[model samples]
Every structure is written in C-alpha cells, then in structure tokens.
Target: MRRNVRVAAYAVCVRDGRILLARWTGAGGPRRWTLPGGGMEHGEDPYGTVVREVEEETGYQVEPVALLGVESARRVIPRRGWRRSAVDHQAVRVMYEVRITGGELRSEVDGSTDLAAWHKLSSVGLLTRVPYVDTALRLWRDRPPTGRAMGSP
Candidate 1:
C-alpha cells in the first residue's frame, strides 16, 4: 500500500445559534456538509489557508480567533483498479474558531463546495454531514487545554 498524508485547516464559525457550513461536492461521491476550509497551498501558512478557503467556499472574510485543536486520523482507501495500490491515507487536520469579518454569503463557483449556508445547531444532526463537523464542534465547545475533547483518546 502507498502512504498519503494530507494537512488541512478548518474553521468553526458559530453565531446566533447557527454554524456556517459548506456542502462538499468533491471525490465524485455523495455531497456532505463540512466546515469552510481546505488544504493549504505549497509553503502557505495554515492561517492563510483557512482565510483563503473560507472566502473561496463561503464568500466570507473570517478572522481565526483561536486554535481549537487538531484531529488526526488514518484510514485505508481501497484500490480503484487492478493497477493501483490501496492507499494508507492519513489526515492531519487543524481546527480553528473563527469570526466572520465581512463579505456576503454565497456559494462557491466551480469549487469543491457547491453551496454555503448557516444551519441551526439543533438541526445539524438531522442533515448529512462529515464526521469532522461534530469533532470540530466538540473541540469548540470543550476547549480543552490539551486541544482534544474531554475523554477523547
């Protein structure tokens, strides 16, 4: 198996009992709601990555107010065809608490996310979403000193 590691940044923007989210339309799979952020460019700072991604995905200018935590996970991606090897994929994700500074809400244009919207906190669990959404929210709510949720291994 080949090993692939990805580093990405995500924002947890909660306001008025709602959270800002973007609908991911990548990987040619089913769409899922996720935080408004993405992978960093070469030599780009994670701070810049989050700001740029938020704007691109949700048309919002955001200022990261605090470092929420990091979530690292490893998974195996089955090979798509006979010639390719199964991938050992690792994701090192950085989460941040951000506040919207400016810009009107709008969907991204021909990007990974097709729609951007704010959803009621209570309604989040009713919608289809990526697991990271819950993870990030937990980090935001707990704000553990170790940057991980309480009792999380």
Candidate 2:
C-alpha cells in the first residue's frame, strides 16, 4: 500500500444558526461537504493555512477564534485519476472555530471546491458531508473543558 501523510486545518464558522461549508471536489468520484479549509503547504503554519484555505475555497476573510482539537486517521483510497495505485492516507487534521471578518461570499472556480454556501445547522444532515464535519460540530457543541478529544469505545 502506498502511504501518504497530510496535515490540514479546518474551520467551523457559524452565524445565525447557519454554518459555512465548501463542496470539496477531489480526485474521488463525488463531492462532499466540509469546512472551509484544507491541507497546509510546505513549511506553512496551521493558522496561516486555515486562513488561506478558507479564503481560497470560500471567498471570505476569517479569524480563527479557538483551537478545537486535532484528529489523526488513516484511510484507504482506491486508485483513481492520476494515482496508479491505491493509497493508504494518513491525515492529521486541526479543527478550529472561526469568525468571519470580511469579504464577499463566492464559490471558487477551477479549484478543489466549486461551491461554497451556508447550511442551516439543524439541517446539515440533508447534505452529503465528510466525517470531520460531524466530529467538529460535536466538539464545538460539547466544548470539552479538559481539551481532550472524545472517542467511541
């Protein structure tokens, strides 16, 4: 198996009972809804990566308010697109709560995300979303004071 490691930052931006999300367009088949952030570039700080990703994916300026948690996971992805072999991908994800500061809302063209919009927090289930969205929302609402992540037994 081909092993790959990725480090990414994600934002949970909520306002007026709605949450901002970007439709992720990866080499995989279908698009999945996720927070407005993505992988950090070489030697890039996580904070700067989140800000840059949020702006690139969803034309909006944001300030990360608090660091929510970190998530590490491994998944198997089938060979597709340019990938000649299946990949065992390990991702270290940093979750953050962010506040929108400025800029207009617009979808990214010719990028990993083609659409960006707000979804009603109560109705997020209607959209196809990545697992991180669920985890981030749970973390945001639970606000575990100890700063420890919860896991299923």
Cα lDDT tens digits for candidate 2, 1-153: 789999999999999999999998877669999999999999999999999999998999999999988878888988867648998999998889999999999999999999999999999988898888888897788887754467721
Clashing pairs in 1: none
Question: Which pairs of residues clash in candidate 2, taking residues 3 or more apart in a chain or in different chains?
Answer: none
The reply for model 2, stretches above 4 Å from the true place, is 80-85, 146-149
Estimate the overall C-alpha local distance difference test score of candidate 2.
Answer: 0.90
Error of 2 at 112 (Å): 0.6
The positional error of residue 87 in candidate 2, measured at the CA in angstroms, is: 2.4
Separate clash counts for every candidate: 0, 0
How far does residue 131 in candidate 1 sit from its true spot (Å)? 0.2
Clashes of 2: 0
Question: CA lDDT, every prediction?
Answer: 0.94, 0.90
